[model samples]
Structure formats: C-alpha cells, structure tokens
Target: MHRRSFDRFNWQDVLREIPPSHIATRVSFFLAGFLMALWASLVPFVKSALGLDEGAFGAVLLSIGFGALVTMPLSGILIGRSGAKKVLAFAVPVASSLLVAAALVPAALPSTAAVVVILFCFGAFFGAIDVGMNIHSVVVEARSGRKLLSGFHALYSIGGVAGAGLMTLLQTAGLPGVGSACALSMLSAVVWLFAGRAMLPDAGRNAESDGHGGPKFVFPKGVVLFLGAVCFILFLVEGSILDWGALFLMDEKGAALEHAGMGFAIFSVAMTVMRFVGDRVIMSIGPKRTVVFGAAAAAFAFVLAVLSPNAWTAAAAFFLVGLGTANIVPIAFAATGEQKEMPMSLAMSAATTLGYAGLLTGPAAIGVLAEATSLSTAFLSEAVLLAAVAAAAALTSVFRKS
Candidate 1:
C-alpha cells in the first residue's frame, strides 16, 4: 500500500504540490508594471535630452500605442502555440532591454526617429508579455480553484508605485537617465531570472487545443464582448485618475502645486489596498453584485469629487473612486477565462486590447470635452459612463455566474 501510494505521485503531481506558479505570476505582473513605470518616470528626461517638441513627443508616444495594438491580437496566437511561460521568458527581457535602449538613445544617438522605433518595439514586447502574464494568471487561478487575479493585479499596482518612487529617488540622487534605466534593467533581469524558473510549463496547452488552433484572430463577441466593454469603462476611469486627477484638484479645487498629486496618490493607495482584499470581496458578494455596486459607487464618487468645493473633499472622493473601481477589471478577466464561447487566451487578449484602447483614448476624450465645455463637465460625462457600466453589470449573465 505504501509503495502504491508513493508510485501515484508523478512529476506533474510534484509540480502541483509545490505550486510556485501563483508566486511567479505575481512577480511577472510586478516586473511588467515596474518596467513600464520606470520608463514613464524617465520620459521627461528623454524628451529634454532628445530635444523633441510637444508635437514630436506626442507622435513618439503614439507609436507605443500603435505598436501595442499591432501586437496584442497576435500575442494570443503566439501564447497558444508556445505557451505563456515560454513567451514571457522571451518577451519580458526583450521589453526591459528595449526600455534601457530607449533611455540610452537620448544620450548616445539622440534621434527622434530612433527613439520612436525603439519605443514602438518596446511597446510590442510589453504588450505581448502583458497578454502572456494574464493568460498564465488564469491558468494558475484555475488550478488553485480560488480567486487570485485580484491579488496578482494588486502586485502590479504596488510595483508601479515602487518603480516610480525608486526611479525618482535615483534621479534625484544625481543619476542620469541612462544610469537609472540601466539600474532598472539590471533589477528586472534579476527578478525575471529568479521567477521565470517557477512559471507553469505548458500553461495554455489545453486552451490552444480547445478549438483555437487556427490562423485567424479571434475577436471578442457575445459575453466576452460585454465583459470587455465593462473593462473598457473601468480602464477609462483608471486612466482618468492617473492623467487628470491631479489637474482636477489643482485647477478646480485650488490645491497647491505641491499638493496637486495628492488626489491620485490617495486613489492609488486606496485602489491597491482594496485590490489586495478583492478576492475575499468577490467570494463573499459574487462578481455580479461586486461589479454592479462597485460601478455605482465609482460613478457616485466621481460626481462627488467633481462637485466637492475643497481639495480635501475631492481627495476623499477620489479615495472612494479607488475602492469602487479596484476589482472590476479582475472580475471581468475572471469571467473571460471561464467563458465558453472562445478560448481563454483569445478571449482575454481581445478583452485586454479593448480595455487598453479605452485607457489610451480616455485622457484625450477628457481633454476634448474639457476644451469644449469644462473639466467638471468632462468628469460628469465619465460618471455617466460609469453608471452605464453599472447597469450593464447588473444585467449581464456572465457577471452573474462569475
């Protein structure tokens, strides 16, 4: 009996028993966020060093989004063929190195065209890694039979904060842009090397075989489309907080220049904390109610922030917005993973692409609205959209089941 029991445990069983996939997924998410944040922190320096004007800089920035759009759909196919772990091992380092390359360009080459090309490539690799990591997260969550996506996303948020803070400290301590990028690149390499080994092998193998072995791209439709639409709204709200929250506080609420960032800071902190506890929230309340109530709360908070007379009240409202929007994306992704209409990889890829489109478009939309009407009006428009998201969430059967 003892021999038979010992014989039952195979290598796959061992791998399952010592499941490091979840930890590795979290690390990968963190690394991706860190690399992106580090690049963002160095953007001003890069622009100055390259001597690009606002128009030229904006054009360069658009290249990154263009590249991401080009590659995001293809990533699902790639992950389906090669698996998330293999794709990530190749993509993450390439993306990080490209970031270092972009930083070095301003110092050595200093060409706008070169910077654009490098950044485009960086965005391509980054987008691929993003899809790969999320696919991996789904696999891990499936195996664990628990809610882990929220916590994984929380690590990404934490990584963003840490990366931005550390890069700022390094620059303030007299490090050049290239030097800072180099340090971050090295750190990224170390983290990936350690974590890459533990990632689940062949993570999307079943997904690939689930009628997704085709040459064409699979776009989100049906329930996947609904979930993606919800994600789009949530991502738009998040982007608004990042890009316009500070401006809203400073311009509308009379916040000092030094205090301008407090709104976003509070939002980020609240969001991070809520995401850390989001799994429990989802388990207790279910995804449907969580998303519906969360969207309502976010819409109400946004209106409150827009109407608040003082900076402190606006910051409080922003904090509420954070808590309200924290888990919507995770829930959406979780639903995508379980949807029967398409392969998880393709569904998630399409959903992520739509969500990213909303994020990229949001600030520009707000700017247009603000220019035509007022910033307050622009925010009110977003609140209305959030309300629509809430309604959709309440009606969607996918959210009901997930």
Candidate 2:
C-alpha cells in the first residue's frame, strides 16, 4: 500500500533530486514575500488608525518610500560586501524590528511626526529585505535552471492573501488595528528567524562581481531604461491595489467594512495562483506575449471595474488585474538579469530601486489624483498606465540586443 501510494507520486522523486537547500532558498524568498505582503496588508489599517485625509495620507506613505529609496541603492553594495546570508540575517531582524515599531507608533505617538518617523523606518527596512531577497532569489534560480522566479514571487502574493485574511479576521474579532499590526509584525520576524538557518549562504554572490565591474553603479541605459519603465508600470498597478483597492470597494462599491478586504484578497489569490503557473506560461507563451497580453487584459479588467454597475463585477475586475500583473514584474527581472551593459547584481538592484520607487510613489500619486478628481479617476489613470506597459512589451523585442 505504501509503495502504491509512493508510486502514484513520481513527481516527488524528481523533485527530490534537486538540492534541498534550493528549496529552502525558495522558502526564504517566500518569507520575504510575507514581509512585503504584511506591509501592503497594513496600508488600510494604517490609514484608518491615523484618520488621515488624502493629502496627509499620501505624504505619510511617501515617508516609507523615502526610506526604501535611501536603502535600495545600498542593497547591492551591502550584499556584495556581506553576502546574502549575512545581509539577510542582519537586515531581516532589523526590518522586522521596524515593522513592530511602526505598528506600535500609534501607541507611542499620535502626532503626525511620529507617524512619519515610523513609516520611514518601515520603508527603509522593507526595501533592504526586498532587494536582498530578490538578489537571493535570482541566484537560486540561476542555479536551478528552472523558471522558478515567477513562482517565488507568487509566494509573496500568497503572503498578501494570508496577511490580509489574518488582518480581516482580527479586525472582525474587534482587535484594535494597532494590536493586530504588532502581532503580525512580530510573527513575521519570528518566522524569518526560524527559517534563517535553513537559508542559502551564497544567495547574493553575484554582488561581488557587480561591485568590481567597470562602474559600481550605472544609470539605466537603452533597453534597461525601457525595462525599468515597464517595471514601474507594473509596480504601480500593485501599489494601487494595495493602497486603494479597499477604499474603492467601500467608497464606490459600498461594500461593508467586513467585506471590503475581499477586493485585495481576490487580487492576491489570482496573482499568487498565476505566478505558480507563470513559469510554465512564460515557457510556453514567451515573455513578450506574456507581458503584452497580460497588460492588455489587466487594463481591460480595471476598465470593467470602473464601468461595472455591480459589486460582483468590481470583484471580478480586481481578479483580472491580479492575473494580468502576476508575470510582468518577473519577466522584467529576468530581462534585467539578461542585460549585458551592467552586472546582473547591479542591474537587478537598480531595477529593484526603480520598481520600488514606483511602489513608494505610486500609491501617493493615486491619492493626489484622488484628491483632485476621484478614486475612479485615479483607477482610470492606472488603466492607462497598464495599457502603456502593454505597448512597451510589444516593442521590447527591438531592444533585445542591449
């Protein structure tokens, strides 16, 4: 009976041939995703807890962006000097500390300055983890020679679903946002720490080569700039969902407080599931088609969301948005790695910096638009941005040499 069961799962035997550490590396990357999702998940709670208006909220979120921007450039330098293991071991705990600190800021200081300081800290630490983990993920993917990057990123989307669901549950139970925030922050820190020993030691080894190569840092050039723009668009879509998706449901769709979280939850699940299958999709359909079609679909989805007369249609739009966005960023990362003008590490770090900038600035940019017009108008802007990305994807093949 045992043999029969084991025989039914021959896939496990093939998977076992792959090094266990690579699997652990993937898991480590998964934890980093959790951190990103945790931050994204906390956006609504932070907005409500602070009772911020659009302008003020945008400004406050910018502090986190400022924090991340400051560290993203340094990520390659640090990873180069220290390696992914040491950098992650140090950075993850420090970042986790900041999460806990940010979560507790309401209790510590109710003033605007206090909020800025807390978010700034969160952004810096989160950026460090973001670059560090992706650096590690790229290295692991190279070693495996498989299309695992998208799947690795998918785990982050999954983390978003998990974090959002948990947050929703806690909110439903009447737990104060502050307590729930702190609890998750601390929980993620513990999870990263527990998984630390199992993680790879040389995940960012490419940083050394990048550091010694011609210029330590070079601005995006030619195709690199184009790819970065594509990344910017994709991250912007994600930022919209994170920062405003819930508000859209509540303000426009008139969803109940308990159910508002479903919008992002659906997006997160669709994105996560697609990412797991994304590698296969990319392998079969190719990156260009994936990006072109995905962006178009996403744009249409957002339009559906805006034009939809009912709440259920709005929900469906969010899912399509997630599905369309799932592979664009991963493909961009793959292109960054393939670029010859810069070392893989430095190029990736730069791409990450730019992409994260979009994340940092994108949400607040929407808020500013929302203040001037309305959330629906802001969403319309996102649809336009995504359509531009689809056009960019169609043109990407021309710059393949650079």
Candidate 3:
C-alpha cells in the first residue's frame, strides 16, 4: 500500500520525467501564494504611509476582499472562453506589477483613494489567478490520473513560508519596507515570466461545454453546492484561526501578546507539513476517509482548544486542527472536477467564491458573536460547524455511492 501510494508521487519521476504543463501548474500555485504573502507583509508600511487609524485601515483592507469578490465569479467564465493559461498569463503580470505599484504608493501619493483602487485591482487579479490556477491543476491531474492536487496545494504553502520569511529577513537586515517590497515584487514578476512559459495553452477549454457557447456562470448546485457549503465552513475555520486565535490565547489562556502569535504560527507550520504529506495519506485512505477522519480530528481539536486550561495546551490543539484539516479543499477540488453538475471551471469558480466569502466575513462574524457571548462560545460554535462539515463531506454525493 505504501509503495503504491509512493509510486503516485515518486520523487525521481517528478524531478526528471515531469511534463512542462505540470511544472507550469506548480509554479502558478507557488507564484500566487508568494505574491499574496508578499503584499501581506507590506500592509503595515502602507498603513503608516496612509496615516489611517485602525478602523480606517480595516476599511481599506476590505478593498482587497472586495476585489476578490468582484473578479472570482468572472474567472470561470473567462477561463471557459480563454483557457486557464491565457487567464493566468494575463492576470499574473497585472498582479505582480501591482505589488510594486502598491509599495510605491507611499512615495507617489499616499492617498487612501489610490491605495484602495490599486489594492482592489491587486486583489482582483489574485482572485482571478486563484480560480485559473486551480482549474489548471484539475485538468493536469485528470490527464495524469494521479493524486497530485494536494501536493500542488502544498507548493502554495511552501511559497507562502518563503515569501513571509524573505520579507522578515529583509526587515531584519534593516532594509526599508517599501524598497524591500518593490524589490521582492520585481523578483516575483521575473520568476513568473520564466515559470509561466510552460503552462498548457488549452487547459480548461474542453470541459463539458454544450457547444462553442461554453459554460455560463451558474450558482453552485448538486454536488457542487455541497462542496461550496463545505468550503464555506472550512474557510471560516481557517479565517477564524488566522484572525482570532491569537486573541483567544492572550485573553482566555493568559499568553503574552508577543507569544500569542505562536498559536497561529503553530497552525500554519503544521498545516504546511501535513499538506506535504496529504497526497500520500489520501492515497492510502482515500478521500472519504481522509475528509471524515480529518474533519473529525479538527473538530475535536477545536473542542480541546475551547477546554484547555492553559495557552500551551490550546496551541497544541490548534496544531492538531491544522494537521487534520490540511487537505480538505484539495480533495474538494478533485471531487468537483469529477462531478457532472456543471462545467469543471464554472463549478470551481462558484465553490471558490463562496469559500472566500466565508474567509472575508467569518472574522467579523466571530467578533460579533464574541461580543454578544464570549470568544470561547464563538469558538465552540465553529467546532459545531466543523463537525457539520465532516458530516456534510461524508454524506455528499461526491464521496457517497450514487
């Protein structure tokens, strides 16, 4: 069993026999992750330059989310017409160029209006590429008949770490934030220029389109709807942890402000490692077992976190949550690719858009719940929802026999 699963991801074959299209898909995921993280690292510098207070800054940050919302649904339609590579090739340059443009805002105008618009475009491209690249991965995985989606997702995690670490090192070396941002964004553009060249020119255009009219954007339904609903809860879990876990540790568990960050850090590291191993694990156990067991584990971890007597134990619970929930969306994507409910690219877009809606709204929703009740209560609610996610995945048509 182990050898068979390992054969699915043989390192020797990957290094020497890998096709150019596969490489392009991998690079696309990595570049998207890296560029997004790079922009994230520049937020503080932009905030300072704009002279915005906390509330105002948070409002501005919404532009990024807004950008994503605007373009995400359109991505599927665009890909169906233009193909994933064309969509990616067009979006990547705009996205990467905007990274430097965002950094340069401080020197240029320092206007809130300009920053919001630029970041909006920045986010739009990011969301477009997010949909484009996943569609590309689906097509590539289908042709290869291998369980490569999780590994492809793993590259995004690796890219995120590299991006954040690079920004940190530059800051530690005393480089100015804006300068570092500009330089790194330039490097990203250069890297993409080379890596994107091998992308499949015709991927995502051959999905079950009824004719030359291609697939129109439809709301998620059937298996696609279940996948979207599952993605919503999972992305909610992720967003909550990223945005609120530190506060929960600090206030409820008595962690120092500086050390509270370790909660999310532990989650990120664990999730990254698990993603690297996820393809093999899914191969060994299959997606149904992976989702059922993984979401159950994460739900239990949330319960542990809620009941923990101290910050350290709660952090450990979060680590478990990360490990358990790592491969969920990849499995969902793979399943969606197989469904006949809609065109592969269109289903991906609808599900992805709904999933990101959870991320964008979840943190604020948690805040409202915490204010009305308590953070622990809010977290416990997420635990319940995660359990539901597990139930939903296990019972969904994609995993269940028709």
Candidate 4:
C-alpha cells in the first residue's frame, strides 16, 4: 500500500499543495517533547508509589535506555523501508499507550518487573518516534532550502517546558499522577491525529537513490564518528542538567529544595531562547565556529557553575551553559543530513544512538563519580569533556565547510 502511494506521489506537487507540512513537522517535534516531559514529571510520584529504593528505581530507569538502544538502529531501517510517516503512526500511539500503562503501574502491576517491561516498551516506541520525526525534519528542511532545524528544536524545548510545567501544576492542584498521565497521553494522541495528516507522506522513501536498497547497517565512520562524539558530549551535558543540576544546587550551592529547580529553569529558558535565534548565529559564524565557541562557552560556564558560592550564581552559570549547548546538536544534525558517506537515515541513526547513550548514562556516571570523589569533581570532569569536544569540533572537517 505504501509502495503504491509512493509510486503515485509527486514531490513537487506535494510541496506546492501541502502548505501545512512544516507546521505538522513542528507539531510532531512538540508532541515528542511534551510526552517525554510529562513522563519525567511523573517519575517521582511513580517511584514513591512503587516504594522502590534508589537502586531499584535506578534499575527501572535503565530499562528505558536499554530499550532505546535496542530499537534506535532499527528505526533507520524501518524509516528507509516504510517511510517516517507510517513508522510514526505506529510508534507514537504505542508510546502513548505505554505511558498510560506506566502511569497505572503503581496500582495495576504487582511487581517492579512489570513496570520495567512497560517502561522498556515505552522507550522502544519513543526512540523510534524520535528518529522518525528527525528524519522527517531533515527532509522538510532540505525541501525548504533554508536553516529551520534550530526553530524546530526550539519548539521541542518549549513543549518540554510547557508539558512539565502544566503537569506539575495539575498535580500540585491535587490531580493524581495516573489522571495527569492519562490526560496528557490523550492530548498527545489528539495532536498526533491532526498533525499526522499534514506530515510529508513517505518522506524517507527516497533516502537512497536506488530506493531503500542501501546497506543494512551503517556504523559511524570518519567524520560521522567525530560528529557523534561531539553529540555524545553535548547530550551528556544536557542529561546531566536535567538529572543532576538541581541536586547540585541543593547539595553544593545551599539552595533550598523548592528553589533547586531554578537552575534547570534558567538553563532551559536560555536554551530555548538561543535556539530561537540559532539559525541566524549559524548563518553568521557557520557551524564550525558556532560549535567551537559554543563548546568553549559551555565548558567555561561549567567551571563557573562549579565554583559558584551561591545558588543564584550557579543558576547564572547554568544559563550560560544552556546558551552554549543549545545549537550544537541542531548544527550537528544539519551536518549529518548533508554528509555524503552514508545514507542520511543511517548517519542520523548512528549519531542519535551514541548521543542518546550519553544522555542515558551521564547521570549515573556522575553519581558514581560523586560517590568516589565529589559532585564538584564530577562536574569538573564534565568541563574537561566539553573542552575535548571543543578541540574535536575545531579539528573536524565536517563543519568546516558549513
């Protein structure tokens, strides 16, 4: 059925006729971020309800990463064969359902194993959707002949803020975690139904000139690997902020529990604002200098954040970190879309896989390091990693031309 549709499709006609295609892509990015943030906001409640210790909770959390790792490589293949729209159609709904199941796990499931399975399934679907939407975005950006990837990512950041903020408010207003999760899941489904209508149909069908006849596997090689490493560091920094930034403020900077979240809020706001203008920055400085200066800024900010004596100063430093890291991933993804060594889908898959691995493991790695040394030392280590990322970005030829 998809092949028949693909055969009858005309790319030029579609571009001319479907004016909402770009809006649809943005909405898809928003929905993906919204769902993930909603899930994140409910994590504490879930952990409390399950009565799990830190170790058990950590183990359960690992399931999501494991599932994503298992599924991310296959996403490129699926998109190559089936197109991003079909994959998203299947993946989004599955992910939504799994989120609902996770919300109900406290009451419905008797064991941690069941919750882990549900989270694993949720991660699998979520990972697939992540890659699919990105593949779709790359196609859309290419068709538009401009730099719009940063704006698309900015919407994701906005969605994350909105989703988590709204859910936190609702829960604070006395809604149960299960009810909040269900409501958000339904909202996401509705958005998907509408937005899926306007998505470019079979966007990934032409990924290869021969039409899905490319190699089965595409491991990162050469500049792609270097790009992936840069992505890994940036993503690890991002994940560290999400998971540990607040704890760092509270533990090391003498921030109250209520005020601890301010660090991430400052970081997030800075990131979102920077991303809104990132295309212009890239246009002015190009991706190479953008990455080089961005990494250096973030590393310096990390140093300042670590040395800060109070929460306010730390928040200020975090804001700088956010500004620095905001555009690196978008720039990298744009580079990935243009590279000629492999199919875009494969390159994107490899990069997303490695980057996500960093996001998944960064928090735990920091925790382990902190136990052995201190949080300050762990963060200093991150600053050193960012410096390495800067050096690597300076040396890589991929961004030099862009």
- For all candidates in order, the CA lDDT equals 0.86, 0.77, 0.87, 0.86
- Residue 218, candidate 2: Cα error in Å is 2.2
TM-score of each: 0.91, 0.80, 0.93, 0.89
Q: Write the per-residue lDDT of candidate 2 for residues 77-193, one digit (tens) a residue.
A: 677655667777777777777777666665556577887887787778777778877877776776677777898887766665667678778889998766776677777767777
**How much is the lDDT of residue 161 in candidate 4?**
80
Say which prediction, candidate 2 or candidate 3, comes out ahead on lDDT: 3
Instruction: Evaluate model 3: give its lDDT.
Output: 0.87
Query: Model 3 clash pairs?
Result: none
Off by over 4 Å in 1: 1-18, 172-174, 206-215
Task: Flag clash pairs in model 2.
Answer: none
Question: Number of backbone collisions per candidate, in order?
Answer: 0, 0, 0, 0
Candidates 2 and 4 compared: the better one by lDDT is 4
Query: lDDT of model 4 at residue 82?
Result: 71
Please write out the lDDT profile of model 1 over residues 1-402, one tens digit for every residue: 999988886988666765688779989989988988988887897899888898889888998887887898888887777678888888888888888888887879888888999999988988898888988898898788888888999999888988988887887999775688777887797789889988988875444354346545776789888888887888888888888988999999999999999988899899999999999999999989988898899899989998899999999999999999999998888888888888777888898888888889988899899999998899999899989989977776778756
lDDT of 3 by residue, 1-402 (tens): 999997798687767788888988888888878888898898888898899899999999999999998999899888887788888888998898898989897667889999999989998999999999998898898888778888898889888888889889998999887788778878877877887888887777754543367767788888898888888888999999999999999999999988999999999888889988898898888888888889999999999998999999999999999998898888888888788878888888888888899999998999999999999999999889888888876776575411
Better of 3 and 4 by TM-score: 3
Candidate 1 lDDT for residue 24: 93
Candidate 4: 10-residue stretch with minimal lDDT? 205-214
